[model samples]
Target: MPAPTDYLLTHGGHRVEVTYKNVKNLRLRVLLGGRVVVSVPLGVPEHELRRFLDENHAWILRAQQRMRMAAPPQEQLVDGGRVQLWGAWRELVVADGDRASAREVDGRIIVTGADEEARARGIDALYRRELMARIPALREVWEERVGRRAAGLRLRRMTSRWGSCNTRTAMITLNTALAKRDPAALEYVLVHELVHLHERGHGPRFVAWMDALIPDWRARRLAMRGTP
Candidate 1:
C-alpha cells in the first residue's frame, strides 16, 4: 500500500486535513483544539471528497464545537497566576531561593527557585509527590472494595484522559494532572480504573458495577470536569 497523502481542504470557512489511505470507507475525526481530520480510500477523487465533506459539514462543525467546549483551559505558571489545587483556584507565588521547592503557604502555592524553569519544575515535582503520597491509600481502599489488586500504579502528565487501566496486567496509570483537581476526584478515578479490573468496557454491566462501587460516581465525574 502507498503512503497516505495529506492535503488541506477548506470549505464554508472551515479547514480540514484530508488524508487518503488504503481503506474502503471514509473516516472523520475532530481532534482537540478543533482540528479536523478526514481519512478516505486512496482512489477517492477530490470532487467526491468535497461532496462528502459538504454532506457532513454540520457534523464537522458540531464536533469541532464540542471539542472546543471539552478542551481544558491553559494555565500560566507564573507569579500571581492562579492554579487549580484540590479543585480550588489558588494564587501561585514564585520566589528566588538557593534550592527549588514548591509548597502551599497561606493558602497559596509557593514555588521557590532560581528561575522560571526551575519554578515550573518545582511545581511539577510537588504535584508528583502529592500523587505518590495519595494514590497508595486510595488504591488500597478501592482494591479492598473491588477485591482485586493492581500490579502497580504509574503517574504521568496527560492532556486527554484522567486515568487508564490495564485489565490484563492489573496496573493502573493515573494522570499527574489530577493533583490539580479535588482529591475526591482522584479517588473517583482510582475507583473507576480499579473497577475496570473486573469489567472491561463501559457498557451496562460496567455502569452497574460503578454504581454499586461508588454510588455517586457520576457526580464525582461532573465535579472533576466542572461540567454539567
Candidate 2:
C-alpha cells in the first residue's frame, strides 16, 4: 500500500482529518475521543469531500456526542477512596488477603488482597464478573428483539468504546467499565452493538433501529458522562 496523503477539513465548527488513501470508496468514522476521520480514494477533490461531510454532518455530530459521553469515573478505586458502582457511588473498603478479590457487601465495595494494585484488580475482576453475569440475560432479550444472534460475547476494559460488534464472527465485545454505569447504559450499548450485526455503519437504518427499539437511547448515552 502507498503512503496516504492527509488533509484537514473544517465542518460544523469541527476539524475533520481527511486521509486520501488507496481505497475505492470514501469512508468516514468518528473515533473514540471524538476525533473525526474520513478516508477517501486517491484524487477525490476537496469540494466533493466537503459535500460528503455536509451530507453526513448530523451523523458525525451524533457520533461525537456519543464518544464524549464516556468521561471515565472520577473516583479512585483505592482503599478508603470512593468508587461508582452501577451508577451509585460506594465506599471502597480494602483488607489484606492471600489473593485479590472484591465484592459488594452492605452498600460498600469490599476488596480483599495484598496491595492497592491487587485490590484494584479485584475491583476490575468484580466489574468483569458483574458484566458477565448480567449480559447473558440482556443478550437473550436483545437478540430476540433485533432478530440477530451473536456467536459469543466478551468483556474488556476499554478507554475508547462502549461496545463493538464483529459482523463476520457474530461476536460482540463490551467494555467492562459499563458495569459501573447506570444499568440503562448497558442496555443501550447492547442494543447498539447488536444492531450492528446487520447494519454495518451508523447510518439511517441503524438510527431507525435505535429509534424503534429504544426511544430514550440518546438520553441514556448522553447521561453516561455524568458523575454520580
Candidate 3:
C-alpha cells in the first residue's frame, strides 16, 4: 500500500481535503471547526470527484452549520465536575479507590480512586452497565415489532455513529455514547437498527417503517444530533 496524497477540492467557493485511498466509496467528513475532508478511491476520476463535491455541497453546508451551533464539550471529570447520565446532567463526585468503579447515588455519579484515564474508564463502565441492563428488554420488544431478531450485540466507543447493524451477520453494534444521551435516543437507535435487519437501506420503505413505528424518531434524531 502506498501513502495517500491529499489535494484540495473546491466547488462554488467550498474547499475540502481530498485524499485518494484504497476505499471503494467516496467518504466525506466535516471535522471540528467545519473543516471538510473527503476520502476518494484511487481509481475515481477528477471530474467525478468534483461532481461529488458539487452534489454534497448542501449537506456539507448543513454539517458546518451544525458544527458551528453545537454546544461545547462537557467539562473534564474531576472532583466537582459534572456527568451526563441518560441525557441528564448530574454532579460528579470523585472518591478514593485503588481501581476504577463508578455508581450513581442520590442522582450523583461518584467515582473512586481514579486518575485521568481511569476516571474515563470508570464512567464508560457506568454507561455500559446502564446500557446492558436496558438493552435486553428493548431488544425483545423491538425485535417483535420489527419482525427480526439480532443474533448478537456489541458495545464500543464510536467516534461518529450511535449504532450500526450488520444485516448479513444479524448483529448490532451500539455506541456507548448513546448511554450519555436521552434514553429515548438509545431506543431510537436500537429500533433503527432492528428495522435495518429487514430493510437494507434508508430508502422509502425504511422511512415508512421508521415513521410508522417510531413516530417521533426524527425529533429524537434531531435532538441527539445536538444542532437541530
Q: Pick the candidate with the highest TM-score.
A: 3
Candidate closer to the true structure by lDDT (higher is better), 1 or 2? 2
**Candidate 1 has which clashing residue pairs, if any?**
none
lDDT of each: 0.81, 0.84, 0.86
lDDT computed for candidate 1: 0.81
| Clash count, one per candidate | 0, 0, 1
**Candidate 2 residue lDDT tens string, 1-228:** 554477677888879998888889999999986899999988887788889999999998778755644545357656556677888877677776858999999888888877778777888999998888888898889899999999998888788888899999999999988988889999999999999998989999999999999999999988977422
> How much is 154 displaced in model 3, in angstroms?
1.0
Q: Over 4 Å off in model 1, which ranges?
A: 1-74, 98-100, 226-228
By lDDT, the best candidate is: 3
**Candidate 3 residue lDDT tens string, 65-162:** 56744546564588656778888776677998869888999888899754878888999999999999999999899999999999999999988889
TM-score of 2: 0.65
Q: Could you tell me which 10 consecutive residues in candidate 3 have the lowest summed lDDT? A: 67-76
RMSD of each: 17.4, 21.0, 19.5
Candidate 2 vs candidate 3, lDDT winner: 3
**Tens digit of lDDT per residue, candidate 1, span 82-192?**
566777676677777847789988877888878777777777788889889888777777899888889999887777899999989998988888988879889989988
